[model samples]
Structure formats: C-alpha cells, structure tokens
Target: ATSVRRGLRSTLRLGNRLAEEWWRQGIAWRAMRRGEVVVFDRHFFADYHAYDIAGTDLPLSRRLHGFLLAHAYPKPDLVIYLDAPPEVLLARKGEGTIEALARRRQDYLSLAAVTTSFEVVDATRTLDEVTSEVIALIRAFEQRHGAMATTS
Candidate 1:
C-alpha cells in the first residue's frame, strides 16, 4: 500500500511538471487565442487518473496535484469524448484487456458526467458516421458562438 501510494505520488509529480512545461509553451492557447479549434488527441484529464492506485484514503498531496494540473491550462470550451465498447477497443488495439478498457470507459463517463461542457459520441459506429457527428456538433457550436476567424 505504501509503495503504491509512493508510485502514484511520483507519477503525479512528473505529470504536473510536464503539464506546466506544456502550458508555458502556449501551443494550444495560441491556437485558441486566434479563434482556431484546437483538437487535442489526448488531454490532461485522461492521463491524470489513468492509473488506479489502490488506497482507501487518497492523500491530500495527490488531490492538490490533480487540482493544480487541471488549472495549469485553460479548460477547453468543449470536450467531445469518443467512446467505444471494450471489446471493440480490444479488437482494434490488441493490447488492453476488456476489464481494463471497461474501467477506462467508466472513468471517462464519470468525468463527462461532472464536466459542464462535454459530449459523448459513440465511436463503435462507422468512421464516417463518427466524423459526421463530430462535424455536426462543431457546426452547432459555431452557430451558437459565431464562426471563428480562420486566419491568425
């Protein structure tokens, strides 16, 4: 238990350091500043709680680290979570077990539940269908917020 706690703390500290550096780079922020749609392949939220470190009492340090990392960069205006079944993910990736995939799916669902600006899309559908859904969502967002300026 002690070792698991230490490992979690170490991982979080490293993640926090890397996120701070990325925030300083301003790559995402610059694009958003110019009204460009920033598509993040994998955001901090996914990675922050990727591991399930077993412990009855989560340390305050861990919570603080998560809070700081989350606040390191401005939250995205919209987060589109593409979700697929565990079996589908396993068939495609040929890596993680169904249990692991299911756990991740639950984590993502829980995160989406708490987040104010988030949408979940079924990725088990055809690629074209998924793309169309995402495009439709983006269009709706644009209609609501007005079109973003194309040029910086």
Candidate 2:
C-alpha cells in the first residue's frame, strides 16, 4: 500500500509539472505572437535535465513524457549559462551540497553542448563585470539577428 501511495503521489506530481510546463509554453508563444521578447529565468528542459528527472531511471511513461516535452517545447533564442566552480557557488549561494552542485553544473554543460544558441559566462567575476559581459553577448546577438540595439 505504501508503494502504491508513493506511485500515486509521483504520478500526480508528474501531471502537475506537465501542466505547469504547458502553461509556460503558452505564455511564451503568446508573447512571441505579440513580438515581445520572452526571457525565461530557468527553462523546463534544462531544469528537468539538471534535476535528473529526465534521466533513464524513471518508468517508461515518465521518460517518454519528459522526452516529448523536451522535443516539443520551443527552443529559446539564447541560453546563457553563468558558470562558477562548485566551491564558489557554495560560498556565494550558501545552498546545495558541493557534490550536487557539481553534478548540476555538469548536467547544464552537457545540455549546452547540444544547444545551438548557448553561451557560458564565468560567474566568478564581480557583478558589474558579469553584467557587462552578458550585455555584450545580448548586443552581439541582436546585431547578428539584425535587431536594433536598445539602450537602457
């Protein structure tokens, strides 16, 4: 009975997560339809991959669901990965085990490897430095895409 309850709970959680992803996709599409730039702080595919929820250990149904969601979801125009060493991350964030952070960093890098519009920025620098680098990247992308630069 406990096993059955756990299964039911996991199933429910999966359903809820799917609904959230779908809703987020809808919002992105709507914003793009209006010619608005949609920026996601954290994307669903990367989140799932980092958390290992999309890994091969799950039952076939869950794995298939994750695969479908990853493939069907619209790819972002740019994915910037702010990378810092796990020790630095722990020192700065004061959260997450070093081992887990390392794993997640690797996972993110793996995803970025296959992603076309991806950039890795060193996050160990000062805030101003990091911000400047990111702005430069965005400006370069805009120029490449023929979008007028925005000053703000």
Candidate 3:
C-alpha cells in the first residue's frame, strides 16, 4: 500500500516535470539507437500505474491506445521477463511484506501483455545460469543490431 502510493505520487509528480521527462526519454532513446545493450531496471509502469487497489482489473488496452496515439507503439526492441516463484522472490525480500511483494510480482505479469519484445526467464535457475542467459541474449541482439554506443 505504501509503496504503491509512493510510486504513484512519484510518477504523477514527475510527470509534471517536463524537463526531467524529456531528458530521460532523450537519454534512453539515444542509448537505444546507439545500439547500446541497455537494461532497464524497472520498465514496469502498467504494473504500478495501471492498477486499482485490492488487485481487481486494469484497462491495459487504454494505456496501449494512448501509447499508440503518441506513436509509441511497437514499443521496445526487446524485453526480458524474469519469472521466479513467489517463494524465490520472497527469499530476497529486503523490507517489503509478502503482500507488497506479491502485488509487485503480479503487476509485472499483468504488464507483460503490453510489451512485444518480452523474454520470460525462469527464476528457478541458479544465478549463474540466469546471468549467462541474459548475456547471451543481449549479445545476440547486439550482434544483429550492430553494437550500441553510450555517450556517458
């Protein structure tokens, strides 16, 4: 509850800052076009934003429509979906309660629909396997896309 509220507040509040928004989008797009193998820590908006309390329903199509109208369709080039059991996720819980963690996990699954470039990875694997798989996929993407450059 607290996390959801805070995340909403930050997003809505940040939305008011056009400069930040533009800067972020600019950097992200730049990196993308440069062919940099960038990994977004949390590209989970529909997860947090497109939801109602008590975990009822989300009008995801509405958001997709908005993105399309904004010419934001055909979204990211690739998205990696990391899926692990709740127990596995909970094993690494930092501070949030089980309930919050569950909410976040479900949110990711829900948002998975809006993305086309999604790769689902079973979190049941060992850390080494996960890293290796991610690296291989990213390398493949880079190979096909011709390496990415970073300005920073």
* lDDT of candidate 2 over 48-141, digit per residue (tens): 7644344777775578567766677555667888999999999988999999999989988887765667899999999999989988887787
**Angstrom error at residue 145, model 2:** 3.2
**How far does residue 46 in candidate 3 sit from its true spot (Å)?**
5.1
lDDT top scorer: 2
RMSD of each: 5.1, 4.3, 7.1
lDDT, candidate 2, at 142? 77
lDDT of 1 by residue, 1-152 (tens): 99998878788876776666477437766876777777777666555543322223556565655565566544455678899999999999999899999997887776665455678899999999999999888888778867543321
**Model 1: per-residue Cα lDDT at residue 39:** 72
Task: Enumerate clash totals for all models, in the order shown.
Answer: 0, 0, 4
Who is ahead in lDDT, 1 or 3? Answer: 1
Decide which is better by TM-score, 2 or 3. Answer: 2
Highest TM-score scorer: 2
Q: What is residue 31's positional error in candidate 3, in angstroms?
A: 2.3
Arrange candidates by TM-score, descending.
2, 1, 3
How would you order the candidates by lDDT, starting with the best? 2, 1, 3
User: What TM-score, computed on C-alpha atoms, does each candidate reach?
Assistant: 0.73, 0.82, 0.60
Instruction: Name the 10 consecutive residues with the lowest summed lDDT in model 3.
Output: 46-55
